[model samples]
Target: MKVNPTTLSWQAPTTNVDGSLIDYELEYEVGIAGDSTEGDYAPLATIPGQLRERETYVAPIADLPLDHGEHTIALRSFDKAQPDRMSEWSEPVTFMLATVPERPLELRVT
Candidate 1:
C-alpha cells in the first residue's frame, strides 16, 4: 500500500501442501505489465537460502522502487539444502500508489 518505498514486511509463507517450509524466498519487479516483451515477471530482488522461519520478513524496497501504479511481488517456499528445492512462486501480491492531484486554482466562499 502507498507504493511501499520502505521495507516491506510480509508473513512467511505458510506450510506447503507437501509439508516443507524451511526457508523463504522473495522477489519483486516494478514496471508496467505491457512493457515486458516475454513475461510480466521481472527479477527485481531475491532472498534465497534464508534460515529461521520468522513471523515476518522485512524486505527493503530501495532496489525495486515503484512509481504511481500497480506492482506485483512474488514469493516461494524453500527447503534448507544445496540446490534448494523450491516451490513455484506463490501468487503475487499487488500494491498501488496514490497520485498527486492538481491544486485548486482559487478558493471561493459562496
Candidate 2:
C-alpha cells in the first residue's frame, strides 16, 4: 500500500483460479490497534467493473482526520463470480501523522 497527501492506493490482487471478474472492494482502518473503536474506520467501498489482465486497481483518497500517532490501514480483494470468496487481507501498513510545533524559535547573532 502507498500513501500520498490525500490518497492511499494499491494494486488489486489477481485471481488465482479461473473465474470471471466482477468488481473490487477497498477497506481501511485508522488509529492504534486494540485501543481504537469501530467508528475510527471507514466503511468498505465497492467498485463495480471487470479487471483487465495485469491491470492495477486504485481507489480514491479516503477522508480521515490527521491525528498524531501511528495509524493502520488494511485492504482486501473480492471476486464477483464468487461473492462468498475473498482474498486474504494484505499486510497492514502503518503511517504516522506528526504534530507540528506551534511556535518557531528565532536565532540571535552577536
Candidate 3:
C-alpha cells in the first residue's frame, strides 16, 4: 500500500484584531486532531515568522504523523513582536487518508 501526501494551504491574514493593516512578518503553527476531537489536536509544525513573506502558505503532509483515517486540521498565526499573542484557529478542515495498491510486476498464463 502507498499513501499519498497531503498539501495544506491557507491565506495569510492582512490585518490585526483592530482592523489595522499588519506591519510585521507572521509565523504559523499547524495542528491536527484525530477523529475530529477538539482536545485531541496536537501541534504538527511551527513555521518561523521571518522565513515567509507571501500572502499564502503551503505545507507538505509527507512528514506529518497521520494515520489511514479521518483527521481534522487547523492553524494559528503569530508574530515576533508578540510571541505570546496568537490569532484564533481557523475553521477545521477534515480529510481522509487512503492508500493505493501497487501494480502487478509480472503475470503469466497457465
- On lDDT, the leading prediction is 3
Cα lDDT, all candidates: 0.53, 0.50, 0.74
Better of 2 and 3 by lDDT: 3
Model 1 ranges with Cα > 4 A deviation: 14-16, 20-40, 48-54, 65-69, 96-110
Clashing residue pairs for model 3: none
Predicted candidate 1: what Cα RMSD to the true structure?
Answer: 6.0
Q: Which ten residues in a row have the lowest lDDT in candidate 1?
A: 25-34
The digit string of per-residue lDDT tens for model 3 on 28-88 reads: 8878865555645578878665444385577777657777876677888988677687888
User: Model 2 lDDT vs. the true structure?
Assistant: 0.50
Judge candidate 1 at residue 25 and give its lDDT: 46
Rate residue 68 of model 1 by lDDT. Answer: 61
Q: For residues 1-110, what per-residue lDDT tens digits would candidate 2 score against the true structure?
A: 23343555566544444675534542222223344563243434454433323465444434454455666756655556665665555666676666556686786788
All candidates: TM-score: 0.48, 0.45, 0.71
The prediction achieving the highest TM-score against the true structure is 3
Q: What TM-score should be assigned to candidate 2?
A: 0.45
Candidate 1 at residue 48, lDDT? 43
Tell me the lDDT of model 3 at 4: 55
Instruction: Output the worst ten-in-a-row residue range by lDDT, candidate 2.
Output: 26-35
